[model samples]
Target: MSQLDAIYQLHPKRYRDKIEEESNYASIENQKQAVLSIGSLGVAICSLIIFLIPYSTTIRGVIAALALPIVYFSFPYIAISVAAERRRKEMERVLPDALLLISTNIKSGTSINRAFLASSREEFGPLEDELRTTAIEISGGKSVQEALDNLRKRVNSGLFQDTLKVLSDAIESGGNTAELLESSAEDIRTSLELREEVKSSIRMYTIFIVMAAVFGAPILFSITVYMAETTTQMWSQTDLSGEASSFASGGSTGLSFEQPDVNTDFLVQFSILALTITNFFASLIISQISNGNMKEGAKYIPFTVSISVGLFLAVKTLLGSFL
Candidate 1:
């Protein structure tokens, strides 16, 4: 066997099948290599940066070791999943149009396979490609049901798969396919419209949540952190040695003053960490509210985290400079 086939064989059947179904990667070996390359680069970069951290050598080494496998494996999966999601969205956007066109072709007396071919147009994008592929398979003497099933397997869309299953059942039962397609098309459009309406109704809530997470939380944390730093500074400069001497000498009233065991560095690090976590979850919540998919929130994560952390630091610096 060839080297690529040998490498492909190392994967379990289910993993290979999942990659094929969820991604547009034509070659499993190529995808595997791409993932390996991306992961290795990420690990190398992270390893170099980990040494520069102001942490103990043991802590830095531990972090670097843990990051190696995590970054190497997770980054490629994240990239591929994002691409698949974008493709699924594009397919969904064109699905209603493709169904209407297919129904129209059926009304004009074209066979089902021919109707699919007729509906395959550039405007339909990925769905058009799937339709043309299925039509070719049917023309090559493959069973229509098998060809349609293969088409569904190639797409990572639950709605598309469910629609195809319904169509397959209708075909097997000798139902009026054209009317079914038309009704399905109408239903899908209505569903999409209703989804949009729901999103619109919650628009204000989404905005408020985003503003609170990205703006209010950061500002509050910055102010709180600044106060903490100021308190620590003030305590550090205060002459507590006098109080210690007096107390040691058993002199006067029982009041004593000492610095609280507060680490300003730890507090600043904690504030940044809290802001990052808050922004991450806020992004996910916003995505779930607006797009109905939590995975879609990954696109917003960097923006939210960067803005929140940057704003916090900027505000803290401004407070330090002026006050």
Candidate 2:
């Protein structure tokens, strides 16, 4: 057997089924193999590059070790999830049009199978391809319900699945399939429009979240750091020697403030940590507002981190130059 088959066998049955359902590829085993191969190669290359960086050996080794597993495991999952999301979005985008076309065909006195076959046009994208396959399956002696069920399984889209269930029921019950298709198409279009309006309405909240996490937090933290550093410097240069002598001679009350032992390095590190965590959740919130899925926020993480950190460093430099 091939390596892909071996890997497929090693995975649990449920996971294999999920991979097959989500992926657009013809073969689940090949998709898994591609994911694994690409992930492993990417991790290996990254680890080597990290090792060659001009850092302490212990620090470099620690980073490499921690990154290896995260990259190896997450890259494949991320790739698969992104691919699935794109496929689902494409299907959702064109589904209403495909439905209307099928409805039109059926209204023009075509059989249900022929309506589906007629609607398999290039303009429908992946939905067209799926319809073509379903038509072929029905032509090859499978029942219409069975072929549609298979189409539902292969597409793995909730909207499409729900439409298929309705279509299947209508077909089995001798209902008006054309009317059902038209109604389903209208509902899907209304849903898509409502989603877009909701997203637009939440744009303000998304902007607020991003500003608070990336700009507001970083600016506040930088100002705090600057104030702390200034206080420490000013205290260090104070005439504390005279205060100590006066306290010894009872010239004044023995109350003298000493320089705070706040480590600037620790403050900088904490600021970075705070910014990262804030931006991470902020991205999640934005995703939830816009897409209703927290996982969709993953793509924003790198952007959030880079922008927040860059702004922080820039603010620090600007403040340092003035101070």
Candidate 3:
């Protein structure tokens, strides 16, 4: 057995439906195995590099162990989710045109199967594949309702599923299929336009979230670190001068004070953790505002965290050089 088949056979039901729906052409098991294998390999390499860093052995070991498992599990899910979303978007974009075409063909006295076959154009992209598959299934002795229901099951979009249901009901009721399809097409188009308007209306909020996560937070943290470092240096100098004065005054000056040890490394590590967490949540919020799904925002986390950490380091370095 192939590696993918072996792995999938071990647990066939784990994410099987989602994997099948999201993967356009590849076998679901193969897609799952590819994602898991590549993700694990990449995470292992990164863990090795991290282990080589100057962190304490226990901290590095903990990070490596935690990060590897998290990445291994998360990468496959994220990959599949993203693929599903892209497929949904493509389907949505072409759905109106496909519906209109099918409706026009039906109006021209073409049967439902012929209408779907005629409407399955290359311009429809993924929707075309689904339409062609449905037509083929109907031609091969499958009932029209069963073929259409199967098509709906294969698609991940709620709008497309609803459209299929309306079409199926119209067909069953012997209603005006062409008119119902035309109406459904119009409604889908209107809904898509309204969603676009909503996204545009909330554009400013998205921008603000990105700015706060990537730039504002980093600058503030950099300034705090700079201030802490300056305070530590000042306190060290004060202690040295106070000791000198006390020694010069035959140890009677009484001006010595214990300096607090502010660990810069700890502060830097804390700042990184804080910024990562802050940007992760910020990305989720942005995703929710734009797409109404927080999981859709997970893809933005890496970019947000990378930019925030890079800006933090750059600002820290610039301030260190100047201050």
The weakest ten consecutive residues by lDDT in model 1 span 20-29
TM-score of 3: 0.90
lDDT of 3 by residue, 1-323 (tens): 77677666554475655556566422243575666675777687678767766788898888887787777666666767776777788889989989999999989999888899999999998788789889999999998899999988787789999999988888888999999988999999999999999999999999998888899999999999999999998887774775667676895656555788999878998899899899989988999999987778888988999999999999999999986
TM-score of each: 0.87, 0.85, 0.90
Model 3 misplacement above 4 A: 9-29, 45-49, 239-255
* TM-score of candidate 1 to 2 decimals: 0.87
**Ranking of predictions according to lDDT:** 3, 1, 2
Query: Which parts of model 2 have CA positions greater than 4 angstroms off?
Result: 3-20, 24-29, 41-68, 251-256
Model 1 over residues 27-121: C-alpha lDDT tens digits? 13367666656567777876886776678989988887787778766666666666778888888888998999999999999998999999999
lDDT of each: 0.83, 0.82, 0.84
Clashes of each: 0, 0, 0
Candidate 1, 249: how far from true, in Å? 8.1
